[model samples]
Target: MKKKLLPLALAAAVLAGTMAGCGSSSAASSAAHNTAAPAASSSSSAASSTPSAENVTLNFAIWDSNQEKGLRKIADNFEAANPGIKIKINVTGWSDYWTMLEAGATGGSLPDVFWMHSNEIYRYGSNGMLLDLTDRISKSDKFKLSDYPDQLSKIYNISGKQYAVPKDYDTIGLWYNKTLFDKAGLKYPDETWTWDTLYNAAKKLTKNGVYGILTPLHNQEGFYNFIYQNNGKVISDDKKKSGYDDPATIQAMEYYTKFIREKLSPQIFGDKERAEAMENGLCAMGFFGSWNLSGFAENQYMAKNFDVTVLPQGKTRATIFNGLGNAISANTKHPEEAWRFVEYLSTKEAQEEQAKLGVAISAYNGAADLWVSSNKTFHVKSFIDMVKYAVIRPYSNKTTAWEDRAYETLKPCFTGKQTVKQACQNTAKQMNEALAAE
Candidate 1:
């Protein structure tokens, strides 16, 4: 087991705002009841039996409030079937959620169940903070690791012990405003598009305060895709070093930064602001995740003006794919109940419900189709079809440590304070040192 030290000052800031916008109990209760049941039947009999255990409540922590409605429905249904168990879901934003989890981990008060990310999985799983689900999953008649994506299933397995089950996955796509393309007399992005096509379009589409596309500094949903598409790697396959110093990787990064430097996109914008700009017609295009399908579909302006397609190609077509896993705390008082709930959450029944509600692309193999068809306004199927070119996100035991540092080192490139080559070299030096330490 290994423990990576997190900056305490950053942890304090995370906890300070952790409770912001946490929904009220009444609201959660109402949403739980209002959740629509999925059309599919449970694939297995109840995954756990609690005949001898005392009635108990399990705390479930998640980040996205957007998917809370569907998850609450699943929780409500789980409670209905397992009358002795109740689920209390805590919804926190991404930054705060991890902060709260770190605090909880330190205080030995983690939620009974929580979402786990690849970036942090190694830190928690290797430290024995996550429950060992190997035996539970192995002995379960209803669950099999083979049933989930191999990449996702392997991610939660630290040193041959299982800790989490795949919940859902996301891939990147080119989300564009149809009205903007029409106004510019440009054809909509399609399979034939290449990086050059995007560049030319961005130049043509940059006339009226509106930028052609948002090139976010984000790795998973942004430059990572370009790096892979250009046959570059962010981390070496052996997971022992950083690949940022590679010529192809640096080339991809420089190309990405060109948009920001040339004024094809705003000098400063983040994920939320970029999405907002797209919705408000301030930006014509953006590289976003499939998870945004629900948000864009629900937004009146985006629903009417925007649609999605496969990201334009580079040397080859590719997108960074990542998934979240449902994990239980190693120290929970209600291990059986927690395992039961987690098992139920991984079932095809629950996964289907997640898809039908457009919460995300379900991890269950065939269920992604349902999610694609769930919202008809956009060509959501593009996300599903692009899976052929998907690359699993790059991560290691100390992913967050190096990822955060890389972002800081690379910021100067986006702000024009340093050359892309210099910034990338600096990031590689820092990342290599981090990996060596790990």
Candidate 2:
């Protein structure tokens, strides 16, 4: 996991570089609109007393609409317990959510409480845009930092200040269409499978109209796992450089791209398209996160024909683990109420509800068992079992900046325009520059 250390000057420089490349007037307009919106009244300090019985609505923001039903249920339960507060959920897709939050940060209109990601936490927390929950957490009787995973709790803690609370976590898994396996006369993926096994199965399954797999250029669900499994690092332990140019990293990249080059996987499919293709039976296998449970459970074909297993091994076994954190705006009018709600969301009861709805694997340790048993259609235990071998998702203060550049810089290899080694070399050069600037 990445630590927070970006200086404001470095952050500004990276943001300028990013925005200069994005020449979209519509995005600028949206930012302008967000800047002009009304902001929550600034509180003098964190509230220490129970909120009075005055009706108040807290603006809760999240990116995943698929989990809205479960969250709404949790909100309703919170309302029932408190009686004087109402929670209004604001659903925005992943990309737009950050854009709006960036705009909101500038205008002081960020949602009263919102979800925070590791990639952007340093930016917001360092800017003082998030409420300082350190004092409140210490004073609270119902919450304890030890209730969630230590790494997850530490992710949102910037410079000794607790800015957010862990909400849910996910680990990558190998999803396969069993029907395709049966048709290919291949056995189901299991603990004994390795990279070579996956390669051989993909070759055999690539017949007719369906490709054997879908290997999108996604860092989390795609190449990052392979890099780690091959004993290669993404960023160094000191967070000072890129590891893309390492021999093992390059080898892993070449191995992953081989699927695309051999036509065992589609050459063109974004993350969403890959999932849809899998659901529609155009692909036989793919690497995805535990959050896909909600969508897969609802998809008629996937519910009956799809299942998951631990990712095949490389030199060693590994999976990327990441989670969402719930945070409050620094300028919220009702700090006490917001804390009450945020705290409620982290409780074991709320987490269990989140799990039982099949929304996500709750961050609370034992609560994941409920999630595994919530749905019986697939081997959900595979996701939890992989946790023992999980590696925290690698990130840096300016992770998005370098991550975006690496993706674009490496695109040529995916299209056969450049050799994998050349692409890896170029990506390392650019990523190093980005890290140096930060």
Question: Listing every candidate in turn, what is its Cα RMSD in Å to the true structure after a full C-alpha superposition?
Answer: 7.0, 9.2
In model 1, the clashing pairs are none
Backbone clash numbers for all candidates listed? 0, 0
How many pairs of residues in model 2 come into backbone collision? 0
lDDT of 1 by residue, 1-438 (tens): 000122222222222211111100111111222354333234334434554267898999877656766778788777767768888878765676778899999999999999888888899999989999999999976667788899889989988999999998888889888999999999999989999999999999998788988886777667888999999999999999899999999999999999999999886434434444555577898876776665456556666788889999999999888888999999999998899889888877778888998878899888998898788889989988888888988989888889878888999999999999999999999999999999
lDDT comparing candidate 2 with the true structure: 0.77
TM-score of each: 0.90, 0.88
lDDT tens digits by residue: candidate 2, 177-289: 99999999999999999999999999999999999998877777788889999999889987788999999999999999999999999985354355456666888998777
Report RMSD for candidate 2. 9.2
Candidate topping TM-score: 1
Q: Residue 141's C-alpha lDDT in candidate 2?
A: 71
CA lDDT, every prediction? 0.78, 0.77
